[model samples]
Target chain A: MNIDSIKNGYVIDHITAGQAMNIYHFLNLDAMDCPIAIIKNASSKRMGKKDIIKIDIETDINLDILGFIDKDLTINVIKNGERIKKYNPELPATVKNIIKCKNPRCITSTEQELDHIFKLTDKKNNVYRCLYCEAKAGK
Target chain B: MRHLIDITDLSVEELDELLDLASDIAENPKKYQESCKHKKLASLFFEPSTRTRLSFEAAMFDLGGNVLTVSDANSSSASKGESVADTAKTVSCYADIIAMRHPKEGAPFVASKNASIPVINAGDGGHNHPTQTLTDLLTIKREKGRLDNLTVGFCGDLKFGRTVHSLIDALSRYTNIKFVLISPEELKLPSYVKKDVLAANNLEYVQTADLEEVIPQLDILYMTRVQRERFFNEEDYLRLKDSYILTPEKLKKAKEDLAILHPLPRVNEISVAIDEDPRACYFKQVLNGKFVRMALILTLLKEAGTL
Candidate 1:
């Protein structure tokens, strides 16, 4: 398989196997007009198998959504066909409009214009609770 | 700028201060009778409420403050599609403080953010009702003469009982407090509350299905009604509503000094036979609700420069 390296883009690597699709959808990669490649179950030395996403455009990505999805995934900034920088996304204290509160009793459920917000309650367990009802965010 | 949205919003020191103020009011009512004179309280109830709304109005009345009430959503501008923020802002112009109760959880939180005057969450679905917790605290303090070094048993629908959660959060701040949570398996206290409020605070608590077995050790037994409004299925509500009926027989094993507390408008979870018992402090809890609310109104009004 010969996949062309991007000149100026991002390579989202070290994604847990079978999670590239989740990242792609959450990051709204499907809406992007640039060239993109999602390599699933790629061979890796550290991980048994990993998924990687290569994007061919310079655009701002929502790291909060990405980190909420999987914090272990590394974001590689590529410039002129060379990796310029790489870093891990940090878990946000709070995220807005990333996910809707599922609890029917939550205020956000009735008020259509209200922003759906969730706060990180348990960092170790990656638990996010709705800011309105305190209901645990569903997967 | 100050709002009473959750019980944890007030610290132990603030709670003690409020208790002291409430106690002072109870002892010397004449001294604080006109403290809130010329001030007004707006009671906005988006849902139907009897005790909380009336108590808040009664509290303001006791302080010589007038009250403006919007008893239900249908009778208010909310029926004409006004948002909570707008209603709060509009009410702020007419009153010194606002007490709100909405069926949707966190509605008062939104009101607090938008309202210029201080806001109090009377009740918001199965969420925090800080005033109720304050009332419970005063009751416990009066009955036991202290807040700490006690075994408290919370009985009945702990899952949907916002009062139980708020009281637990409030009491967790005190030292030497142990909790005995008595509820049916299906209606047990939420794990997040246990993990965040109990385990996070390093408080000790035991969960059990049997109330009689743990009665003798309790310094306080907080009984909660299985709320039909909280349940989506009528069958589930009916099945669990009668789960923990505190009869005279059930109280036989309870400690002589045990303080029985309930956030009332009861649906037979507590028998009428037990009302005459010396241990029953639920009625006193209702009266405390008014006094503590008086203290709360004074505190918020003073802080807001409205008093």
Candidate 2:
């Protein structure tokens, strides 16, 4: 109904509603005490219904995963009293240090001590491949 | 590498090396038992797999490796609302390696990407099963003494059979191999595979609706269950059920060296009477699965400098 602004925090606005939990888990924010507000089923003219998260601390947002849900979501960094930096997530080159791959048969899924890395292959298709299994997404 | 996601990632030489080592392990089990000692393996099977999980555990045990497992999806955090990726990252922290079997396509690939450790795809949902491919290759080699230049017959449901698809793709790399694709017209090989994998290579093959017509010609009679449910029409399934049954009478037409292979836990595709045949090699294929897995473990750990 109204545009509520943040004082000195970050807001991830315009996230797809159902994916809020997925986003939450991907970022591992359940245990943090940084005063995070997750607003789900919020009103949006473009999306009809939307979700947003506000964190009252300076943290690096992973736009790579955000790009997966809705590329249009906005990331605003709050400074002393005003929004300073803004992030318009570009589709990542390689999905590194970001979302874990979902293919259960990929080598990254098995090796307990290895980093699950993926190369974002097709920009238009949003396709990725596991570094171990070389299993491309959409397979 | 964190996972054995696909066999295609392995070059021919690398695959051969694994096969060679598997053979060596099969021959000399005592030498490899100490290879992964003090190391732990976790099999997080999200699907019900009796054979694959047992082979994996046995392989680890034979290698003097310990194992932790979550075999049933309902028993794990997956039964809650945890994302597959988060579960992978969490499990990656627990074990040295993970073998996952999921009903979803590309599930292990997801775990491999999230984990810093190796991921072995025990199997996935009708997409790819590289380990099974390895086992089939090893079986072909062990029984036939080679992977090249043979007439391989695919009986029963070729259309939706993932193992047939993988085996055809793998064995096609060999020289002078011909295919005798025996399935009913209703359940023929998928067209993309026919176009891309079979015809693209200029390999010799024949598609036949009749198994009896070509049973005598094959060197490897690879039988897959012609499930009644595979048919869109029940009448069609009944009409075809009697055709694909592998019997001693059928084996009478096969070569003396003709190896009868199946990716088993058989369910009436091959008649129980056929099990007593000397050419029945599917049970030994199960044992070969362990050896190949052991070879894979040693190679991956050796590469990681942990073995």
Number of the top-ranking candidate, with lDDT as the measure: 1
Error of 2 at B289 (Å): 1.1
Candidate 1 Cα errors over 4 Å, as ranges: A30-33, A41-49, A58-64, B226-243
Candidate 2 residues lying further than 4 Å off, grouped into runs, are A1-139
Task: Tell me each candidate's i-RMS in Å.
Answer: 0.8, 6.5
Docking quality category of candidate 1 according to DockQ thresholds: medium
All models: lDDT?
A: 0.90, 0.82
Candidate 1 chain A lowest-lDDT run of ten? A58-67
Q: Judge candidate 2 at residue B304 and give its lDDT.
A: 65
TM-score of each: 0.91, 0.71
lDDT string for model 1 (B184-210, tens) is: 777899997898899998999999988
lDDT per residue (tens digit) for residues B1-307 in model 2: 6458777768778888899999999999998879899988888898899999999999999999999989888989988856667888998787788888887666777777677778888887777899999999998888888888899999988998989998999888888999999999988999978976998899899999888789888999888988887878999999898898888887787788889889986888888887788999998899999999999887877776667
Model 1 scores a TM of: 0.91
Please tell me which predicted candidate would have the highest DockQ against the true structure: 1
